[model samples]
Target: MGSAMNPPSMSEAKPALSRRRGRIQLLLIVLGVVGPMLLATGMYKLQFWVPEGRSYHGELIGNGQTRADLGVQADEQRWQILVTAPKDCAVDCQQLVYLARQIQISLGREAGRASHALAAAQPLSADYAARLDREYPQLQRYPLDAGVFARTTGDKAVPQLWIVDPHGNLVLRYEPNVKGKDLLNDLRHLLKLSNIG
Candidate 1:
């Protein structure tokens, strides 16, 4: 009776302890593999501890729209600073165009990685066309479709600049009044972060 009632012997206890240890080790392995992924997903969904400060000065285009959506063909495989004028290239539009070129020039060693372009809804005035031809030798030109521009930009018909990626994806948009220095900084930041054009 005493033998029958004796506490579990060491030999019998060994297997139970081993099984418990194995279960604990398995649980730890699973946690190590999947813990961070779950935590990251939770943080993204809850917007917890996310940084409030952004480095970009322009409005981010996160709607998955591309240059094609603006009715402009993507011929350049490099990063493009495209100025879009829904109306005639007036004072605001011309200023944005100049800003775009200046920003590209400020890139210095990275200049070849980027190009400046203009998309105008109406034909340029002869004097402006002559000026563009003589002064802006490297500027690319495109015809802007007003109908598509209206659909894409809603009520915003003013001139704006777009930072387009190599894959033709629209990254950011800046108003006509955006400063050249600020735009240069933004483009530099993008070039530094991106491996592609």
Candidate 2:
């Protein structure tokens, strides 16, 4: 009866303390592994802590669409500034094409990692074709399928420029009136952040 009433011996208490310590260590390990995943899931689902301002000037293509969705057959392995002309390459389209070329050239040392391209729904006029040939020898060209382009873009008729990744994923898109300086800044930021082309 006295033995039962007395405090637990040190030898007996050690195992109990060790078991408690082991349980705490195990709990910590579990939390360390699971905590981040839970937090990330919560943040994503709840859309909390997201900033309102965007670092990029162009509209982001978050739908995971690729250049193929635009109906242009391009196999470029580097980053591309693709100007899409769903109609004839009119003045606005021509300006965007010129801007695309200038943007690539302005990239300076990083220019080799990127290329400029034009995809037109209709063939350029003979005079404009000759001019592009003479003036923009490095310009890559593709034929834009009007039907496919129409399906993809709905009724939007305005020509636009796209920043495509090395893997052909569409990134940012700019309207016809986008400034060259703003586009240049966006490309520089993308190049700085990207490891791939």
Candidate 3:
């Protein structure tokens, strides 16, 4: 009778202890998954579509003063396409010039909605310059300012195109190797629905 009233031995307690430990282990596994997922959601919300850190690259030109010299006139609405090329263009360099022209033509009837610029690259052949002027006179030519050019060009390569909308916002950057029709499609989308200043 005394032995019967005594507490159970360690061996007898093992199953209950194991069950309790398993419940705690399961709870920890759940928390490990849930804790990191909640953190990731919060971080994504803060990164994009918010104006937290929108400092621009390159010298932000024509921010205050309106310029007619670049044909980016205050009154005329156009998308300014700027390209960075070396002082003397190699084979890859000529393709970029051709690329800019094709992008404009690819705009088709909406071609007037955009313009191009060669930043820092040297002058072209008389025929080439004349042809560009004839075909897309809105395209401006500027010697690339070394300082601004460096800022926009990153580790891999220089950004091929930086487009400023009519209201003068740097909104789009297309990679250097982009095809003309693809960029034109993007431009068409921009031009269609937008009537805002």
Candidate 4:
């Protein structure tokens, strides 16, 4: 017939059109699900959409050193806040220890997810050590080697603080004079973002 020779009928065209429409709909559905994820990844990697300035409050160590390099066992599944003083527990040293305690407490329900320790340059006086135990029963005490302290902070005589990640990397450092709230803010941010710790 003339119609058969001329072209395909509308009814015959319907299946092809339907196939194309189905493919387009499937493509759109896939893009709807995957496009945002790809965009977010790109934005994060390029730092394009992220807010400017440091997202955290601590002084980043930038050393890339792990706990093993510093002689720690480095086996903790939780995060650790470590304070080291040049000498025995002095006023500032005691204050730093108290700050660590407060920081852990501020974590609230996440408190059990963190640990605290003090590494003294010299052996703490038994009386002072006992007092620390009484006041901060959860704080562990260690004697820090002068070389280790010097290597860590580039100044063996000054009191310093460190934050160790769950993977044992030394990530942040703080001076003895750092505000408690700032340290707490950084810890809270890290814990919230971290999946491993």
Best by lDDT: 2
lDDT at 161 for candidate 1? 97
Clashing pairs in 4: none
User: Which digits, one per residue and each the tens of the lDDT, describe model 3 over residues 110-182?
Assistant: 7777776765445566876677688756667766544444443442234356566776566566666766666
Give the lDDT of residue 123 in candidate 4.
84
Off by over 4 Å in 1: 1-35
lDDT, candidate 1, 56-165, per-residue tens: 99999999999989978758899999999998899999999888888888899999999999998899999999999999999999998888988998957899999999
Which structure among the candidates has the greatest TM-score?
1
lDDT of 2 by residue, 65-154 (tens): 999999999999999999999999999999998999999999999999999999999989999999999999999999998888888888
Q: What value does the lDDT take at residue 80 in candidate 2?
A: 97
- Listed in order, each prediction's TM-score against the native is 0.80, 0.78, 0.52, 0.70
Pairs that collide, model 2? none
What are the lDDT figures for the candidates, one per model? 0.92, 0.93, 0.61, 0.81
Worst 10 residues of 1 by lDDT: 2-11
Model 2 compared with the native: what TM-score? 0.78
**After TM-score superposition, what is the CA distance of residue 116 in candidate 3 from its true location, in Å?**
2.2
